[model samples]
Target chain A: MRIIVPIKQVPETTNVKMDPVTGTMVREGVEAIINPLDLYAIEAAAQLKEKFGSKIVTISMGPAKAEEALREAIAMGCDEAILLTDKAFAGADTWATSYTLAQAIRRIGEFDLILCGERATDGDTGQVGPGIAAWLDLPFATYVSKIESIQDGEIIVERMVENGYEMLSMPMPCLLTVVKEINYPRLPSLKGKIAAKQKQVAYWGTAEIGAQPNNIGLKGSPTRVVKIATPQVARFGKIVQPKDEHELNRALDELIDMLKQKAIL
Target chain B: MEYKGVWILGEQDEGRIKLVTLELLKRGRALADKRNVPLTAILLGEKIDAESLKKLGHYGADQVIVVEHPVLRYYLPEPYLNVCKVLIEKHHPEIMIASATTTGRSLMPALAVKCATGLTADCTELDIEEETGNLIQTRPAIGGNILATIKTPVHRPQMATVRPHSNKPLEPDPQRQAQIIYEKVDENLLGSRVKRIGFKANPAETASIQEADVVVAGGKGFKKAENFKMVHQLANLLNGAVGASRDAVDLGWAPYAAQVGLSGKTVSPKFYLAIGISGSVQHLAGIKTAEMIAAINNDPEAQIFQVTDFGIVADLFEVAPLLIEKLRNHLPDKEA
Candidate 1:
């Protein structure tokens, strides 16, 4: 069996800052890490590899620096790594990103399963996973909480539902977008880190993947960030400070009256 | 044109339809009505048991497309997507609406790609342009610090997935009726990918924080996981659910399921009790839709107070017990 995990490099949420003037995320000095959710996908892939004698390949589509994310996935026990980086890929939305990824996956050839995080934190779109599955014309599942069993060309798993969970099984060559509840990700070992440092990561650009220029980047993206601006903060009411019991009672009464006036009580 | 209507993907689990599907139908029907087009609902399930297709008409559907297949009893992305894709290709609708549930979230993106169109996910608001008949999709951006309105002007079938509970489901009209279109299942496709092995429903008693009417949410101010028990107790007493700020979840004081923020579940319960949470834009985005919001914190200047309908300037540790005690005494037994 072969498992492919698609990972993403995202600006660390804690260090992420917005440029007030430009209304864009300040990324110049922010540290980039493998998207936290993608770690689960990598882990799930590694577990499958361990159990089924499968190979785990980590793929990422981002800037050149995104090689670091692939390296980290290698350190986490991925057998191979591929980085899809090119100037043309910049500013791509989920659709473009998924298209590029689908081409990359096709280039990688045979894979029994494709795994992805439910959504990337930066985009919070959760579209790429299913989008890839769609492009590949494969069966896919999202918000997968647990994998019960996989054998004989079929994969069985638990899908998280609003009220409860349901068991689902799909044939091989399926895509799965996992949630955090699936499994706890493992830390990189010393041996794994050393091996990752020595491993060469493959790089693929749009031309290498045979993708048309019109469908591989910002120009291909149908949706655009027409405008980005901070939402206006609503004005809050004045704070009432009460000095004595009488004043406290009056403030409480006034508050209730206001609630009544608004018909919120 | 083979297809002359708008279609809604109705999501159902455990014999009950999801609320968001109804909400989407309500909005879809309105869109169809505005365009002077038929509103159709696509119901895919196995042994659906009930005559729920009529409910679609009650909520304003001109037709209900029913696909009953045992293979679809449980959601296997392959078969479900295949069925829908075939249906869509055969009958191309002008617009498609789906709930942003786990299934819909999984299916719509893939379906959109198959159709070679664009999709806006987790949209808070959606409307059709009166002149151009394009979808105006509105959603939060930059961790909810910004709101973006997107449009897919060139797409053939405009598609948008809306968050659950964001919009109200229309009231059912028993007198309404619609044509029920039945589609035969392709046995070969159904037998292809995905097989149903077993099903385990989550214990309902576990209580999903997303459904809580009153959420006792804690934040970094809680200091430790042990302190979260107070929140749990209060939630238990109130028959609500426990929630946590992203800070608390990141601090490992709570599980991700209990988190309320941009990355977590967006909840709009009737009453939200935020304990010691200093509201960030992301956190506020998840809870701003609540009907009533109350905040308790030691810091009087906390941002939570700004959006809260009621603010209590007191230490959560102290105020929480007092509020719980007061509610126990003042409220009815069921509420308590």
Candidate 2:
């Protein structure tokens, strides 16, 4: 089996801060990491490799810096790494982004499975995975938590629904967006780290993938961001807490009174 | 092709219709009246009850178009998409709406691609432009830092999937009625490529935090998984459901279903209590609709305190026992 895993480089969600005056993202200290959810996809792919011997080719769509994300995947026992980057690919939305990825997948033909993270933390829309499947016309599943088995030209898995899970069996040449519960990601071993250092990262651009000019970038995106504004987070109401015992009793009384008045008790 | 009516994709299971679908039906009603078009609901399921049908009418649907099949009972996108694709191509409604759920999100984007249309996901606000008659879709983006208003200017059947709890369902009027249109589904097209073996509901789903009026959420300040028991204990005392910040969930202290954040479920509860949580915008976005928020964190400048109405600058471990003891003493029999 030939499995292709798509990974992304995203801003460290915790450290992201908005400039109060300019309302622009302050990306100074936000270190880039392989999207947290994609780690599970990598782990799932490695588990499959261990069970059934196969080659793992990891792909990423970002600037040259995204090569680091690909290298990290190589350290996790991926056989090959492909980085799709170009000035033309900037500002692409999910639809255009998926189109670019589909072109790259076409370039890396003869693949049995395409696996990706459930969603990116920065862009939580989760549209890219399904959008890619649509572009490539492959059966796909999102929020996949468990892989039951790989049997007779198909893969069985459990999809995470609202409060439960459903067992689905799709043919082998499919795409999957996995959740964190899929597997526990393993740490890169010393041998794997050295292999990552020696790994050759292949870089592809629009011309390399033979992508149409208009359908590869911002020009191809259907939706337009007409406006962007920081959501105002003014405190809801006054904060009330007691300073001492007397105040504690008074605060408790006031709370009970308010609830009673609201008929919530 | 003339785009005419307003369409709402009413999602359902065997017997019950989803709350988000009813919420969309209510909104669809107003949009239909504004455009002077009939509001139609397209439902796909094995068996949909009359109560669910009436509720759809009660919320604002004028017509209910159903595609029934045994395979439709479990959602696999292929069949639902096939049924909806055919109906949409034939009807060519001006606007189409579906709930942004596990099912809707999976189905809509593919269908949108199939129909060569545009779609907006997890929208917090939906409106129509008076002059252009375009759908105005607004949603929080870039980790809830900014709200972006997007428009699909050229696409017909302007489509969107709204966030689940963003809108409330209108009161169901049993007296209301709908013209139920049953469309025959092509059995051969349904479940051809992908197959569903079985499905089971997680028992924890029954205690849905979105439905809880009071949510007691904890963060990494709980230290470890074992110390997290106090959160549940406090929830028990308050007659509330237990919630978790993404940090707690990431640390494996709580289940993903309990996670309260942008990537997880949005909650609009009456009273929300945060313990040891330094509120990130991602977490704060979900609870923004919470009526009353209280925070207990040792850090006086913890961001959680900024959003809540009541904030206590103290160790949560110490505060937990005191609040529990006081609540027990104040009202022994009180439920909420």
Candidate 3:
């Protein structure tokens, strides 16, 4: 079996904050790390490698610094890693990104399965996996939580939905966008980390992937971000602290009245 | 080729049209009227009657399109995408909208790619540009720290999957009438390599956070899983759904379905009560659309207070029981 995993590097969202004075993102200290959800996809690939004795190739499409994310995946048990970086890939929307990745995957030749995180924290689109599947004419599933079996050139998995979970079976050479419930990602081994450092990472660009200039970057993107604005949070912030029992009673009465007025009671 | 009409990829559940579909109709009506074009609602299911199909007209569909097949009963990506592609090729709609549900999220991307069109997902704000009549889509990005407005400048049939609960459904008008069209397509387009074998509903979820009008959420301050009982009790008293922050769900105190945040569910409830949540940017993203918010925490300076209309600084243990008592006493006799 040959399994491919697509990962992304994103800003650590927890540390992402806005500067009150400028009303702009405070990007100075926000560290870029592997998208947290993608860890589950990597772990799923690693477990599949452990069980089926297959090779796991992890791929990422980002700036050159994204190589660090690929190396971390290798430390976590990926057999090899590839980085697709180019100035032409910049400003690409999900469509362009999916087209570029699909082109690279085509260059890699045959593969049984591809795994991706449910969505990236930055884009939050969750569209690329299915978009790639469309480009490749492959069957795919999203929010996959469990892989029940993989045999006879087919795979059965459990996927999460709003109401519950659905068990599905798809042919080989399929794609899955996994949820966090799939597995608890494993920590990298010290020896694996040392090996990852010594391993060479291959860098691919638009030319290497043979991507069409019309569909590889900003020019290829169908959608454009015309404007960006911060949402203004509006709240009264009516805070009250009652130190004594009488004060507590008064506060409780006022709260009940407010709730009543809102028809929440 | 002129893309000419507004279309809603309508959804139905258990033979009845879903609320989100109606919500889209309400919003789609405005966009269609602005562009001086007809609005169409397309329904795909196994067995929907004409009576139910015509009801879409009452909600603002100038035309109704129906495609019924046993294979189309359940949503599978390939077959659905194939059928939608065929429809897009035939109709050449200018704008298409769908709910940002699992079904839409699964189908739209593939459909957009197959047709080589642009689709924006989870759009909270949508409008038509005055000059070009392009659909303007606005949605939160970077965990709600910034909102980006996007547009498909050069693609036909501009598509978007709108967030649920962002708009209410319009009032039904029995007087309104629509032309209904039934389509029959090639069987080969319905072929699929995937099969859905079974479905199991999440048993632990007593109420759906997305559908709830009131959400009572707990955070890490509860300290222990058992402490969630009070949160549940409060939710029960208020007739609300139980919600949790990522920390609570991560610690196994709550199920993932009950989590509300960037990685979880986005809830636009009429009222949200945060218990001990510090309101991370991701967490705030989920509830930013809520109509009213209140918080109860021991720390007066908790970040949650910054976004809440009301804040009470006190021990949750004391506050929970007392608040429950007060609500029980004040609730009308029939409600209590």
Interface RMSD of each: 3.6, 2.5, 1.8
What is the TM-score of each predicted model, taking all chains together? 0.88, 0.92, 0.96
Off by over 4 Å in 2: A17-26, A249-265, B204-206, B237-239, B325-336
State the fraction of real interface contacts model 1 keeps.
Answer: 0.46
Q: Chain A TM-score per candidate?
A: 0.86, 0.90, 0.93
Candidate 3 — which residues are off by over 4 angstroms?
A: A18-24, A249-259, B204-207, B331-336
Write one digit per residue (lDDT tens) for candidate 2, span A1-265. 9999988998877446655456456778888998888898899999999989978999989999999999999999898999999999988877788888989998999898888888887777778888888888899898898999998879998998876788989997999989877888999878889989999999999999999988877777777778887777657455555566566555555555554564545
- The digit string of per-residue lDDT tens for model 2 on B184-290 reads 96677786477888888766422777767778899999898998888887787777788999889889888887888875777877788899888886788778777
lDDT of each: 0.77, 0.82, 0.88
Q: TM-score for the second chain in candidate 2? A: 0.91
Clash pairs, model 3 backbone: none
- Per-residue lDDT value at B284 in model 1: 76
Docking class of 3: medium
lDDT of 2 at A183: 80
- Give the clash count for each candidate: 4, 0, 0
| Residue-level error in angstroms, candidate 1, position B58 | 3.0
Enumerate the candidates' DockQ scores in order. Answer: 0.42, 0.56, 0.71
